[model samples]
Target: MTSSDLWDAETAERYDESSAFMFAPDVLDPAVDFLADLAGDGAALELAIGTGRVAIPLAARGVAVIGIELSQPMADQLRRKRSDIPVVVGDMASTAVPGTFSLVYLVWNGLGNLRTQSEQVACFRNAARHLAPGGRFVIELWVPGIRRFPPGQEAVPFHVGAHHVGFDTYDMTTQQGTSHHYRRHPDGSVTYGASNFRYVWPAECDLMAQLAGLELERRVADWTGEPFTTDSESHVSVWRRPEPPSRPLEAPAGA
Candidate 1:
């Protein structure tokens, strides 16, 4: 589906109800903590901060968070949070927001939404543009399942509920995956939600950061800082923006 079809207001509202609970404390808490700690007493920027899932919690922890969102509905949803956070409705690839941040993050496979390698690289550039010197950019994305799905493979399915099921299957050679999300309503109505998109591996993402002049700081399998290995299914990588060109901001004017 097109970007417009996937990210409009109506669709965004339904997102959390559809998918948020799929991940639990194990995933949510560590991810939030990682972002909060990296923020380091400075402001944070969250790209595609859908419904304030992480941003709200981080802000409640007394961190100042600004969100960059593409969908108004998504930003509106975030505004409903009991905790306060600033949000800008704009494109992650092009739109620039004011203020430099110590931490910029894209969570929950948000990087996959960029689709193309160039657009992905543009996201890194945009993050760099908004980052303070020594600021960090954190990304959470899936480890491509290509090695698991050799030629002729079609699907990898898993059961979720007694009635609901989720399947994330990919075509290895084509670089595409169809994530089938399903549910059964109390009224006995069954509905299906699916998104098909391209997938990127961790190494390519490193190159994207390098091309954007950001240096990779760390890579882990999850928010808890599990060491990334060949068996890792998802990755959390951190990148640092280089220090500014001149003397430090805190330096004396005459020096």
Candidate 2:
């Protein structure tokens, strides 16, 4: 894999600053509050918990949070911020973090990092493995913006700013995409970075959750419980592992 394929140390160092939009309280609080309410008195496990962005604050709200992160550098940033949250260094796709949790969440399109359907399905199974009965697995994902694509065009610009340019190039046949970003510096130099993802639709995600023995409980357009619709650009979906069936009480013989 190329250095860019992995979120290595250098990339981790700038993840927070580069993705500041994700850290804004307006954007973050609703997500945290939604997960916190679901967690209740039970613990929550976060997959690909980069820099403890959500986990740290959720912990501050008294929800026990554990994280599994593949990038040590990203986890280190989390540590530098706060040491209270337990973080395990491993791939979120299959890493076995000890103890079952009431909630397992992967936010901000982190599942896209898997880059393949099987890996993403495994991630769902892994989330199921770590969940207590009736517990939830939540994911925040963007709906693929196909309408923006022109005929015969495979690329679409998503962000254009005074100092940065961002776009996505897609391969429709394979459902793969590469999101590219270029940051212009004061010295007139440019830095380019790209991230790979395999976009999965909401229906496809429900099938993956079914394969993991979980069921889609609810899917909203956003964190505030808005109804999902065709016009929605993103969604926050919740899947639940069904609680075990209760055994029927037997009456006394010949009662």
Candidate 3:
């Protein structure tokens, strides 16, 4: 069984509509630009690529892009948009795909979906396994929001909107959390949904990269390359595989 929560047909179908704001040019262009620059004529693999939000635009920019998604329904949704982009339905932590990539990325806090430290570490290893020498693995993840909790508090409200209300409840000991959402329909009926995740610290991610034989290259607060500070709520981190050393030239015969 997959460790991650599966997005069923209903979720997949409504995903684009529910997440419309994320598709705005202002919010999306910077991410595409950041990733495209890193891809730089090389292919990229997106872990948990959902509905081609970033992948579609990134591919339109001439970057060869493929995806690994845990949810077949989500993959089907993506296929409806672009048949040319291939997607494999499997667990991102251990799924294997053909060909090495110059860039492998997991965005939108996808790493947290693993829900276990071991799985998350294996995910790093899997990314490293798919990366060519000097290739980079990038992840956009939220820093744990425990700081927002007051003493004895376990829940934090992340969004309080007219049509949608969302909050997260945390278990400090396990570093696990669940984001709960309530969406009101036009008819005034409400729907509820929740997803579980294991929150990870940036330092823990650094160690995971190290264990995967990748070196930390950069860490920014966002796709725009802002400085990462303790107060930052999220981070976009990049780790690179080391390039092979150049061979020394041999001396001329009888030099």
Candidate 4:
């Protein structure tokens, strides 16, 4: 299993084109709108800001945004569209980007890019470090349905389309999954790519955030603030850094 840096030059180059649907106005508007509202004129730092799919539009909405990306090629792709927003090239799990932000967000399954529990915990810590008092850290990820991987069956198909196909292979013991993608081209060619990630339960995520000094603020099924339900396939969770520690009470006579 690879780390967040798994998006290599080849994967990065094709990323925008391959996942173009995610950028459509209908699909992207809600996400950008949600984050922009949370930012409320304050700065936002995006972890694993791949190709600026969300950051670009969010910045356009008047939120000053910065990004941290491990894949230089992916960051390079975003550089073409906007350069004003700074992007730190480093691991999202431990790398420290400059400045405190009102909001830090990890979206599009990026949090899962960390393939181990320790690494995932580090990512939560990193987010807490970037947040100011009363700031928020948001994450969007799918709830693990890995229990469906009964017996020897390991692969589960999630997407099948005219041009693209995708599946996830679960390792029950390790709680790791390898997401595989394949796209077909007009010239009768196909390209396959895969990345490793650790699937996380919502409760586990909350505990990790707590360990990093964040508290769950809200959770929704999508960017529109819909209530999270057991039937929900994915969730957008918001966690907030509490205010700085208050002064302890002193006894009347200095007891």
TM-score of model number 1: 0.88
Q: Which parts of model 4 have CA positions greater than 4 angstroms off?
A: 150-152, 245-255
Q: What's the ranking of the predictions by lDDT, best on top?
A: 3, 2, 4, 1
Alpha-carbon local distance difference test for all models: 0.81, 0.91, 0.95, 0.89
For every candidate structure, what is the RMSD over all alpha carbons to the true structure, in angstroms? 3.7, 1.9, 1.1, 2.6
**lDDT for position 67 in model 3:** 97
lDDT (10s digit) by residue, model 2, range 1-255:
211146889889988888888899999999999999999999999998999889988999999999998888999999999988889988877789789999999998888888878888899999999999999999999998878887888688888998889998888888888999999878999999888989889999999999999999999999999999999988999999999999999999999
Q: State the lDDT at 187 in candidate 4.
A: 98
Best by lDDT: 3
TM-score of each: 0.88, 0.95, 0.97, 0.93
Residue pairs in candidate 2 whose N, alpha carbon or C atoms collide under 3 angstroms: none
State the local distance difference test value for candidate 1. 0.81
Off by over 4 Å in 3: none
- Model 4, global lDDT: 0.89
